[model samples]
Target: MSTAGPDCPQKWCTGGACDGARLDSLLTEEARWLWEQLAARADRSGEPSMTGGTAVITAPAASTQRAAVLGLLGSRPLAPGERRRIRLEELTLRLRQHGERLTPGAVAAHAAGRALGSTAAERARQIARTTGLRKLRARLAGALPKNARLRPSEEAWQELHRTGRVARVLQHPQPEQLLKTAAEVLRLLPPQGRVDRRLLAFKAAGDPHGLDAGTDLAGLVLAEAAAAGLTTSGMPPRTAWGALGVDLDRLGGGLLSLGVHPDGWLVPARFPLPLPPATLADVSWPAPPHEAPGCS
Candidate 1:
């Protein structure tokens, strides 16, 4: 007779688990395909970053999305010694909200699988061993020297977990601003459009690696450069930031960008050009007619 739903217990559930899961799935697929395309090009040149190195990582799509969220919640370049501060800020904000279910460890594990790969995993364990929850609690204990009777809050545990979450999030596409800027670049370049690669040097906060599709962008750019006969052998590595939120105080922003090349000792004969945006490939599913076997 009675037909009522049980209370969620969460404060608000607007686009909560289902929405988050959908978005995460979409982003993970997008990120992976982009990385693959870049890897394909890099393989041709024999200098592939993600494929060759032991540190290179290839995580499941779900894992990648988690990492992105982690990066947003973790350490920022702007706040030098404010790791705890940022963690407190974000975790407190999330916990203060009712019914929130996301945790820092979940975020960290996902990101660790996606962004850092093997190298990052080691770093994460080190952080735990040296400066993780126990360390933070100890630090808190020391900081309250005069209190003589201070106990860590539940909020503190939340903050501690948030660090890994932020770190993971930062490894993804960065903030929406960078995406907007990228859209502008697409508009400016169009198909077969050539521009000074230097123009975009500072357009992104850091290197393409920090960007959501850093590997893809880097691969495409390098491929384009090689196609134009440009030499990327002597270029210096550059880094940039995503500047995620409107306020821009926290470091929920980390994106990377760089030019790719087919091989070393190559020279350029023409100005740099952007790969056609229409050529953007989706790797979520199997190859369609164009890329399928025996299809022209």
Candidate 2:
């Protein structure tokens, strides 16, 4: 038997030295294409077919139909690139159902039933590491204090630097740099009124998503606001942030009314007809028995 030369396409070369690497690559591609086609067909056939508010098939019948459909897919013709999007959608659904942290390598390994090569694995690790860093930075941002003049003690900085986890996650992390950034952000916060969350982030960190919710900097700012006597009790996340002088978003600005009391009547801002003075007599409203009564 003759070996395949460097120039040979290896399509017909089935000898022992017929370029194992090229054959493996081709096989991997073909396997991926077949998987996509099968996944797409499965997705299409798995959708519920309703007739007059009733399913066309019961659980057992659906299983039988699915088996039959799978058997028939080998003979059926597929459109070019038709399965590409369906494959991705199916993969996403599977990942969500799996309920685990998703990464490119994880997805690939899940599909292939084996670990990826060193190059692909390293790429995935890099992506995961970068994502982790971003989350850590956001957390730090949220925890920042509102007082621009307030500085972390040298001992505190030394302690932070000594932490192994912090050193691993942050690239060239420095206490002075963090403090400087926090000070800049704190200076932008108004003493009495709220500012747009995105605007504050951009002004302070040059990125709108920098001080977003769950970020360390945002948390710190909120803590400072609370210490300054801002009332944020029972408020939504956006409202709470707003009370701390940061508008989380454009919406959710006004008061949120739960509902009207069962016995209460709506009062018109402008009355069409004048009412008698007796109608406006001061009547004490009954308080709930669970708690002490207090004036608003």
Candidate 3:
């Protein structure tokens, strides 16, 4: 019954030392596949697999800074640490996808409100003094889609979870509320057309802190315009949708169900609605005739 020789140590092979060379040759196809999966995961996460342990991807300072800056503006008093952690990763994914790299850190002294190194203090003031949302919006500009459109929040959120194991349903807009939001978009259209879509969206969404570009409301506002067939050239549909306020990956399917095109415009459907210039009599037609008293 003894068949071992060159590869076998003495009479019997022990542990992995003797069979190491033949291990690959001995593996079943399924085992190889499982190993491949584990290897791929390790490659992606920059960490190797362990016996029963799990990997935890720490949030980079850039994402953490972004979260704190935004939270300072207005998040649930203080979001749960776990929630913030998830958001950090989400922000990292979003930024990376857009062809930008952000290393985290706020000016140490500025974070503490003091002066330090010749330029460090100034740099801190520049980056950390977020009196407005301008900087954040600029960062997300490149990551936006070239041709975006809006759909119902429900439709978008459902599409967002179609495949992912870790699914999220962000900013679910109400039917009635969004219908009115659509009306608001229409109401704000200038005679010449082409409003600063993002700015208008931020104002309407009431996020004075800033329109986190990837967020739902930001995309929804622009999507509403696309749905109205008022979207002009320039800007991706997906980007517009995200800015308008939703980021549904498959909004087209939902549009089809509603007899609307993926872009939100109806196909072979209703005669175009009249979009006459607003008259003075329609006071409510233009919500807030002027900006708040001293907005200038």
Q: Model 1: per-residue lDDT, tens digit, 125-229?
A: 645543443444345434443522223343443442443432432344542333233333333332333333334433543442322333444333332222233
Residues 170-224 of candidate 3 have per-residue lDDT tens digits of: 2243433433443344344343434444555555655432234455444444443
* Models ranked on lDDT: 2, 3, 1
Model 2 lDDT tens row, 1-296: 22234322433211222322222322234344333333233233332110012112111223333333232133343433333122333333333333322222232333344333434445566567656644544455456565533233333333343433234334435533544566567667776766887888899988887787766556544543433345343456666666656666564333322332213545453534233222332323335646656844
* Model 1 spans > 4 angstroms off: 1-170, 190-193, 203-296
Full ranking by TM-score: 2, 3, 1
Model 2 TM = 0.27
Roughly what TM-score does model 1 have, to 2 decimal places? 0.16
As a whole number from 0 to 100, the lDDT of residue 194 in candidate 2 is: 62
Q: Which candidate, 1 or 2, would have the higher TM-score against the true structure?
A: 2
Best candidate according to lDDT: 2
Clashes of each: 41, 18, 30
- The better-scoring model by lDDT among 1 and 2 is 2
Candidate 1 shows a clash count of 41
- TM-score of each candidate? 0.16, 0.27, 0.20
- Cα lDDT over the full model 1: 0.32
In candidate 2, position 198 carries an lDDT of 83
Question: Which parts of model 3 have CA positions greater than 4 angstroms off?
Answer: 1-179, 197-199, 209-212, 228-296
